[model samples]
Target: MKFAHEFKETLERECFPDHWLAAAIPYSQLKKCLKKVQRELESLGLDKETLQQLLAEQTVSPNGEPIPLVRYNLDHASSRSLRPCLSIFVHLRHGQVIDAALSPASRAFLQRLSGAHSRPSAIDSSACTTPLATPSPDVSSDDNDEDTEGELERIEVPLVFDGEFFNILQTDVDSLDALQQQEEKSMEAEIKSLGAEVSAVVGPPKRLAKSDLNRWREIFDLYVNAQVFFSSHELDHGSRSSVKAVQQLVWFQKQVQTRGLLQSFKVPSSAVAYSRFLQLNATLLQNLKFQEINKTAITKILKKFDKRTSLGASVTFRSAIRSRNFLAGSVAKKLCAQLSQEVVSTVPRAEDYDCPICFSIAWYPVRLRCSHLFCVRCVIKMQRENKKHCPLCRDEGVMNADLNNIDKSLEKFMKQYFRKETEEKQRANEIERGMEIFGDQYKHSSCVLM
Candidate 1:
C-alpha cells in the first residue's frame, strides 16, 4: 500500500487527539515536494542518472583515501531550516575530466560549467546559480589558456525544493518536540500525585477498616513481575517496543482482573487511584503509539526522499534536525523512570531487602563489611559453621561481623514496611535457635524460660 494512505489510515484509526494530529508530519505534502525536487534537478539537465554518476565521482587524495567530489551538507545555517548545500569539487585543472565514474554527458556538463568565465547564462544559472557562477563557455580546453591554470574549485548546486522539504519537516518535528515536553510535564505531575495517594493507603501498618496495604503490595508485586511497558529482568533491558508494551500491559491488567484486586480494595480511593494508574499507563501507551507511528513516518519519508533524490538523506536528516526529545529520546524511558521513583517506590517491595542466604525478609538485617545483607540468624549459623567469607563477594567479613554489623537503620525499615513478615520471621528464628541449643528436644515456648 502507498505509505501516504497507510499513514493517514493509522492516524485516523488510532483516534489521537486533534491537536496531535495537527502536529504530525505532513507525509503527503513532503512526498509532493520531493516530486518537485526531482523536477527541479531535471530542469538543470541533472537527471537522476546524471546526478548519480556525478555524485559518485571522487578524487583520490595523496593519502590514497577517496574524497567525495560532491559533498552534500544538510546542517543548521544559524538555526534556520537545514540548508542542504550540494558542494561539488569542479576540476578546473586544464578542464580535464576528474574521475572515470563520470559519463560522457556528465563530464562535458561539469567541464563546460567550470570553464565558463562569462556572465551567467540561463542554463549555467539554473545549474549553478551563485552570483559568482559564470555561464558554461563554448571554448574547449584547447582553445582557451584562461581555463587551464586552477585546480578543483568547489561550487554549490542551487536546488530549492529539497531545502523547502527539509524546512517543512524540521519545523513539524520542532512542534512535536514541544508538544511532547508539555504532555510529559502533565504526566509527571500526575505520577507525583498518584504516588502520594497510593502511599497513603499502603504505607502504614495499623490495620483499619479501609486498609488495603496487602492488596496494594500484591498488586505492585504483580505489576513489577509483569514488567509492563518496560522490562526489568536481568537478561532483558528496560526498553520495550510499544507493541511489546501493549502485550505486557494486557497481561498485567488481566492478572489484576483475575485476582479481583479492584473489588477487594478496602480503601475506596485505592480503586480510584488504581484506575487512574491504569489510565496513566494507557495514556502513556497511546502517546508511545503516536510517537512510534510518527517516527516510522519520518523514517519512511526520509527513505523515500533518498530513493527519489539519491541524496542519502535518511542518516543525514536525523543529525541535521535540531531535535533533542521527540526523535532522539524515548517517552517510555523518561516517564517510566519517574513512575518507578514516585509511584512504585512508595510501597517498598520486600524482595528488594530479602536475605541472600534464606531468600526471606532480612529481619535484624546484618550488614556485612562488604555491605551485603542477611538475616541475623543466617549470619549466626554461617559463623557457627566457621564460614568466614561473604557468600556473594567472597569478602572475609563474616567472622569479623559483630554487633556493629547489625544494620539498625535497615532493621527499622524492614520493620516499618514488612511488619507482619518480620514478626513471623522473628518467631521462626527463635524456634530455630532454641532447637539448635537444646538438641531438637526443646519445646518451643513464646513465654520467657524462667
Candidate 2:
C-alpha cells in the first residue's frame, strides 16, 4: 500500500488518468487509501524490512495484518482436505516487536498465485495475534471503505499501451524540419551537378553561316508566296484570277534566276535541273495567251517538258521550219494524242468528280465565282492565301468561306487522288530508269532483225 501511494502520486502528477496519458500502473490502490495503510503500518512498528519480508512470505495483508494460510493437496489420500504446515516463525518475544513469520502453506499459496480469482484476500485477521492486541478502528473501517474506491481507480489505467504514441504526435513538426534541412542540402548538391552537366553538354550556340542564312530566307519567302497563291485560289472568285497570280509566280521565279538570288547558295544539281524545267514551263505559258491554252494543253506542255528533261533530251527545235512543220503535222497529231491520254488518265472521272486542286468529291463541284471548284484543297489553298479576292478572278469580289463546312465526299476524293498520283510518279521514274539502261540495245536488235 505504501508503494501504491507513490505509484498513484506518480500517475496523477503525470496526468495518468487522462485518456491521452500513455503510462499506467498494473495493480489496484488509490493514493489516499495507500497513505492511510502506510501510516497504520508505521504506527504498529512494522518497519520496511519487516513489511517486505512479510509480503515476500505472503503473510502480510493490505491493512498490515499477519495470518495463518492454507493450501490444497492433491497427493494426499483425501484430495479435498486442506494441508497444514508451519514454514514461518512468529517470534513472540516479551516486550519485543512481534516479528511475524510466514508458514510453508502461506508461502506455497503465494507462490501458486496465477489468475485474478486465485489471488489471496487482502484482509486476514485470524493469524497469531496477542490477546492484548486490538484491531485499530482507523485501519478496519478505512480498509473496507477504500477498497471500493481502489477498484474504481484501477479502471482508470489503460489495458494496452501504444509504444509509438508520443513519437507519432511529434513527427509532423520535428520530423518535417529535419527532413527539410536534409532536402535542402540534397537539392544544393543536385543544382551544382546540373550546372556542370549543362556546361559540358552545350558549348555556346553556334553562329549561323551567311550562305545558309540566305538560303533559309529564300526558302521562307518561297513558302510564304506559295501559301498566299494557294489561299487566294480557294476564294469565291479564285479560279479565274489564279492565272494572273500564276503569272506573277512565273515572273518571280525569273527575277530570282536573272538577279542571281540562287547563286548565293550551293544549289544541288537535281534542284537546278528541276528549277530549269519549271522556268521552261513558265516561258511557254507566257508565250501562249491564257485564254488560248486549255488546262489539258497546259498540263501536256508541262509533262512533255518534264519527260524530255528526265530522259536527257533537248526541248527546243533547232530550226523554224522544223518547229512550224512539227506543230502543223503528224508530230502535232502525236503530241495531241499523248496529251489527251495523259489528261484523261490524270483527271478523275465525271462520276468520281473530285477536284484536282482539293482531293474531295462530295461537294456539287460548285465553280467558285472565280470558276474554281469548292473542294477541300481549294478551301485550304484559299485559306493559305488570306487574300480578299480570288486568285483566279480578282475582278469579281470574294466571298468568305469556312473549310470545316466543306463536303466529306470531297475530302475522301482528295485523299485517294494524292495517293494514286504519288504511286504513278514512283512507277514512272522506275520505268524511265529501266528504259535508259536497255532502250538502245533493244532498238539495235530490232534494226538487225529487220
Using TM-score as the measure, which candidate wins? 1
Candidate 1's residue-wise lDDT over 1-450, tens digit each? Answer: 988899999999989999999999999999899999988877665677766776777754322356666666786767757878775655444446454555666567666665663232222222333422222356464554464432445456667998899999999999999989989999999999999998888866664445777888888888888787777677877688888989989998899999998888878889889999999999999999999999999999999887777777888887778887898888988998899889888878888888998998898899998999999999998999999999999999999998988999888878777888899999998888888888789787677877
Highest-scoring model, lDDT: 1
Q: In candidate 2, where is summed lDDT lowest over 10 consecutive residues?
A: 152-161
TM-scores vs. true structure, each candidate = 0.84, 0.16
- Per-residue lDDT tens digits for candidate 2, residues 1-450, read 444354445445543224212212222322223344334434433334443454354333335545432111111113222111112222222222233353344323322321112222323233211112223345554573454222100000011111121122122223323433443354344334433332232221234512222342343355334431334444532322336546656665766676565665443442443354344334323322221222222234224422322211112111101112212322222322332233222333333454554453424333554555554345544666765565555633334555435445654554444444434443544454456778844332112653
Worst 10 residues of 1 by lDDT: 118-127
- Would you give me the overall lDDT of model 2? 0.34
